[model samples]
Target: MKILSITTATNHLSVALNDDDQVISEKNEQDQRNHSEHLDPMIQDILTENRLSLQDIDRFAVAIGPGSYTGLRIGITTVKMFASILEKEVVGISTLKSLAKGIDQKDSLIIAMLDARNDNYFAGGYFGQALTNVIPDGHYHIDQLLEEIKKFSQENNIDQVVFVGSGIDKHDELVQKLGLNYTYGSESQNELHAGLIGKLAVNEEAIDPDKLLPRYLRRTQAEVDWHKRTGKPFAPDSDYVEEV
Candidate 1:
């Protein structure tokens, strides 16, 4: 099966074309400001280089969120549109899970996280080669995540904890303070890799394009400000428009 996967959940944007287990072509760069402009062109470049078209793709996969709000929307919207128009299978892969898969550690706790700023993170924990979900994915403070990791590690008799994703860069010192045997992922492991996303989608069940949505773990700044101004909970689909 030919799978086209996209990852734009962070500053790093990546696109991959995979044929079954083989990655045919991939293009990636660090461009946080212009993901919308680069994503489609990268996709086209890969397809054209392979002598294929969008119609030839059998499945579409995308990183769903817990990163940049705008980046997530752009990637999900583009993939959904293509899948809907082509009537192809669509898979939404978790950004954290993709990071976890990038790490090749066995018999240890694998924690995949994205820096959510202000000492908080979007984190999920997995174990072993199958990437068993030991810690649920969600927004968490650095201290809270550390406590959970320590508890899970002690209780499960696991000695080492492997941390992956951009979050490691910020919280490694705090993780070290716990006095546990922990390691940080490599520079490449920290970046979002669309090839891993495609491999993960191969076994996952496909969902309708209409049902696909960005998995933003927290409310946007705009929503928070709106709530504070009106003293009412902000709904994403609410009938509120700001006049230009």
Candidate 2:
């Protein structure tokens, strides 16, 4: 089976092609806020270099966010269209889960985080050989996340905690204050990799094209502002209008 995967869930944009056993080609670049321009062409380049077409791909995979809202949209929308037109299987991988898979520390508490601004982070906790989630994925304040990690570690008797993802650098001091046996993820671990995403999705079930959507853990700032103005929940179907 052949799989094509795309990841725009972080500051990086990555495209990968995987044959039955391994990644054949991958294109990754740090293109913060320009997924629209880079993603499609990178996809085309990978396919072209490999001498394969969309018809040759047996499945499609994408990182379905808790990261950049716009980046997630760009990546998932592209997959939806391609899969729909080609009638191929499509699976969505959680960005946090993919980050966890990239961590090399075995049996250590893996805390994957993405910057959500204002001292809050999109974080999840995973551990052990299976990379099971100890803390469910969601948006959280730095202190709140640490508290849960501390509690979970003591309960599970996991001694080490490893922080991974692009957001880790911003919260170095806060992570350090936890005073556990801990380490920062490497640069490559901090960036998203479409190859890892494809591998993760290989055995997963595929959802219908129209049914797939980005997993934005919190409402957009515009969505929140709309509620403040009218005291009514923002309807997602309506066009978004940002208040000045």
Candidate 3:
């Protein structure tokens, strides 16, 4: 299947055209402030260069959250729009899973994380080449995440742990202190690769365009502040208004 995948879950923005599991073309740029501006152009460039149009794509895939709030929306919304318009199926790849898939490791626990700032992270653990979800993806404090990793490793008898994603650089010292044989992902494995996202989507069941949604593991600052002011608990479906 020909899949067009997009990743904008972090500062890095990447788009790829994949024929089955192989990457045909990819474009990546580091632009935290300009994903909105670059994403559409990158998609167009890849399709145009490959001599294909939106209708030629058999499937559309996008990283659906646990990263930049605005970035996730941009990518998910764009993919949804295209898929809906073209009447094609859409797959929402997890940002954390995409990071895990980039790592070429087996027989070790892979922890994929994105720094959520203030010593917190969005983390998930995967095992082996099939990327089994050993650790459920969620927002976690540094201490809590480490403890969970230690407990899981001990229980499963997994010897080494591989950590990947934007979260590694900031928490390297803390992760090292865990006393487990662990290694940080290489430069290439740390960033979200759109090609990997496309490949991972190959076996996943595609859903309607409207079913694809951003999976932000935490509440936005706006929602937090709103709760503080009104003393009301914020829920995912809460109708909190964002101030412009």
Q: TM-score winner among the candidates? A: 3
Candidate 3 residues 94-188, lDDT tens each?
89999999887778899999887787888999998799888988888889889999999889887799999876667678777877898888888
Which is superior by lDDT, 1 or 2? 1
Q: Which stretches of candidate 2 lie over 4 Å from their true place?
A: 234-244
Least lDDT summed over 10 consecutive residues: which range in candidate 3?
Answer: 235-244
Query: Each model's TM-score?
Result: 0.92, 0.92, 0.92
TM-score of 2: 0.92
Give the runs in model 1 whose Cα sits over 4 Å from its true position: 233-244
For residues 1-244, could you state the per-residue lDDT of candidate 1 as single tens digits?
A: 9999999899899999998758888899988548988998999999999999999999999999777878989999999999999999999999999999888886879899998778788899999878888898888888988999999988888889888987566655777787788888899998999999998998989999999988887777777778789998667674222211
lDDT of 2 at 56: 93
- Clashes in model 3: which pairs? none
Model 1 residue 129 distance off true place after TM-score fit, in angstroms:
2.1
Worst 10 residues of 2 by lDDT: 235-244
Error of 2 at 153 (Å): 0.1
lDDT of 2 by residue, 141-189 (tens): 8888899999998898877999997566677787778778898889888
